[model samples]
Target: MNADNITSDTRSELPQNSSADAAGEKTLKKVANRLIPYMFSLYILSYLDRINVSFAGLQMYTDLKMTDEAFGFGLAIFFIGYFLFGAPGNLAMEKLGARKWISAIMVVWGAITMALALANSIHSFYVLRFFLGAAEAGFFPGMILYLTYWFPERQRGVAVAKFMAAIPAAGVLGGLISSKILEMGGIMGLPGWKWLFLITGFPSVLMGIVTLFFLTDKPESAKWLTDEEKAWLKGEVEKDRLKAAAAKDSVKLFSRETTGSLVLLSLLYFSLTLGMYGFQLWLPKIIKGFGGLSDGQTALVTVLPAIFQALGMIFIAKSAERTGERKLHVATSAFIAAAGFVLTSLIDNPWLSLVTLSITAFGIWGTVGPFWSLGTSILPARIKAAGIGFVNSTGNLGGFVGPYIVGAIKQSTGSFHYGLYTMAASLIFAGLLSFFSERLLKKGTRIET
Candidate 1:
């Protein structure tokens, strides 16, 4: 509970840099270097696992002859289970700690994903989605819990942004992997979709196992941190906690403040995700509109945005870390994403459309790093896990709404344009919300909590 207990300083005495800025910078670089890779890997693979279904969606649609509603319901069902566990999962991450809880969640979800290879009908898909959602429920929240253990208040935006670099990164990885799997679909008495499910699920199993040994729950738990650094961090955080509480404004992670963050985040996330999720679900089909690429080419093209996204994430995360602020990074990223969506919706030229799409991917992925960091920063460690859990679980509703909404729009209008416009609007709303949120936060409202 004491901040002194959680410091990562390298000395028995705190650094005497004579300036807070210098010491904080050293800590930022040190922590970022140490944790970024592991965080990045975990995030990329975890996200890949979550959205692998989208990659498989095209094939599944063909094999199952899924109606628009049927597919949407199935996609949305994942979040139903995801939402149910929001509070519990984060609390579990906090009480049980990330190492054990996350490992268990990974194993369960991986195994569940592996089981998807057996799905035979819509009924089976629905069942699998429910279980998959339940299994995957805690992973995101577990990540938030994990981060609060390592990052300080000022550094949180960049710290979280780095971890979140995986969203679009997943897109790239998913596309490549999906393409390969699609290629392998007919080789071993299975369809490409089957291969996608099997290959994607296997990583969850492998990563879950790897993380047990590799990941630490907190800096305090790291044998690497110096005693003085640990003490100083503890003192620093506790100082803030006391100040917050004495001001009758305790920043507990699961309080009303956090709920406020969850609301704005979920709303913003919903709109952004609408564009993202719908885009992912129907992208191959949209590319098919170009009428030039083969199914394989379509899948491959789908992967390019992910690469742009990964690069964007890395750039913005490091930038935010250096700047020690999130507003500009987040707002800009959101706006960029919105622009990309708009371009894709309006541009009739294929190359230009794809380029715009990739740019949007860059923005979305770039902004996500800061989005989550901003979400977690206002809260304290105790409920940090749960707060983020609530955020992710709720935000996933956008995931549910996106694909279905897109499909419905497409079906009704007989063009992807309507659906695309719907998605763009979502992105714009999210951007505006982020702008307002930043302003509110600067005034100490924590409205974006």
Candidate 2:
């Protein structure tokens, strides 16, 4: 065809193309609505069961006669199992299907969490924590991979943010409920901490059963979706896969760029987890230090920061999606969190400290959605699951290090100030690394397109 004829033909195709895009978006919205609620519920239960130990530590340490170091070691050991099993677990999920694997993981982890109540000796505590980590290893990364099946890149940031908001939601709910559960101490002659474990653990088991029936492995397999919707979703996914494949010819499973991206992402996540877990595990104790507050009062105080964090995360994720920007969002949030930590440490007033810490919570937790979006955006479909697993697993090692270091500092120094300073520094480093990693990836690397 002549050049003018071809141009005329292409112009005529624009309306049809625009209409198809709109229909695809509508289908995606329906899928997101169907999926996100159930996923969010499962995650809330998962996070609650995993971190309830922070609340349990208040009474369990005294009851078990365990030292700070011992408790810290027990907390840290969970990530060892998490790291070891994470990649393999994700690969297994890719092979076995998300429905079966996610359900199985929840059941096993729930059982382990419940069994934590029976831990009388420090050794038993350590063993149970490790197994808990192993059981829960792939759930988060697997979910991240699973979301890619239903949502295209354009919609993923908001979807991820909505689902991840469950973390902060769990925090708020766990705090409120745990305080009441703790009051149930001596009921049927069981300790409060034991009750906490038992109460929190049961939901996962129930949810796992629900997951078996409710969760579909992929859009192609979803009976609830219309054929048109399925076709559109699948086409979008295939386009992403092809784009990734085209970006790098013969992309190895572990290329230099892949490894570099993994390392940088891991470091970024490590700093985030360090601040996250350290702040969460220590918040109740820190509140108690303000003096004369009952356990219930302390728990109530702890909820404020989580509420702020949930709001911040959702807002930030939406902003990132609207702007189509990732790295700056992640870096800015991390820097805000770093500043919050520093301010918290410097402040003397108890209420002001809590407020500053709330800002810190907002920054660290807020980064989760955009950061994951950034990480997943750069990976090819072939290695996306494994890459996510590597980042999450290695990053979780910070969970171990953060809590343990804080506990050790508390024991030796008689103050949490040093630990707070350390967390602040880690976050600052994370922010800087996040910004530079984007530049590094953009220059002759497949990680940024």
Instruction: Give the distance in Å from residue 355's predicted Cα in candidate 2 to where it truly belongs.
Output: 1.4
Model 1, global lDDT:
0.69
**How much is the lDDT of residue 251 in candidate 1?**
45
The alpha-carbon deviation from the true structure for residue 313 of candidate 2, after best TM-score superposition, in angstroms, is 1.6
lDDT of 2 by residue, 1-449 (tens): 00000000001111157789688768877888899999989988888887788888878988889887788878778878877787788689999999999999999999899999999899999999999988887787788778777876556656665676678888899889988887788999999889999999998988898899999999889999899888888988787667666744546658765777777777888887887788777778777777777766777788998898787677777777677777788889989988988888788889998998899888887777677767776655566645765676667778888888988888888877888888888888888887877576647654342
Ten-residue stretch with the least lDDT total in model 1: 1-10
TM-score for each of the candidates: 0.78, 0.86
- 58-94 in candidate 1: lDDT tens per residue? 6778798887667767776776777777568878888
C-alpha-based local distance difference test score of model 2: 0.78
Each candidate: RMSD to true structure? Answer: 6.1, 7.5
Q: Who wins the TM-score comparison?
A: 2
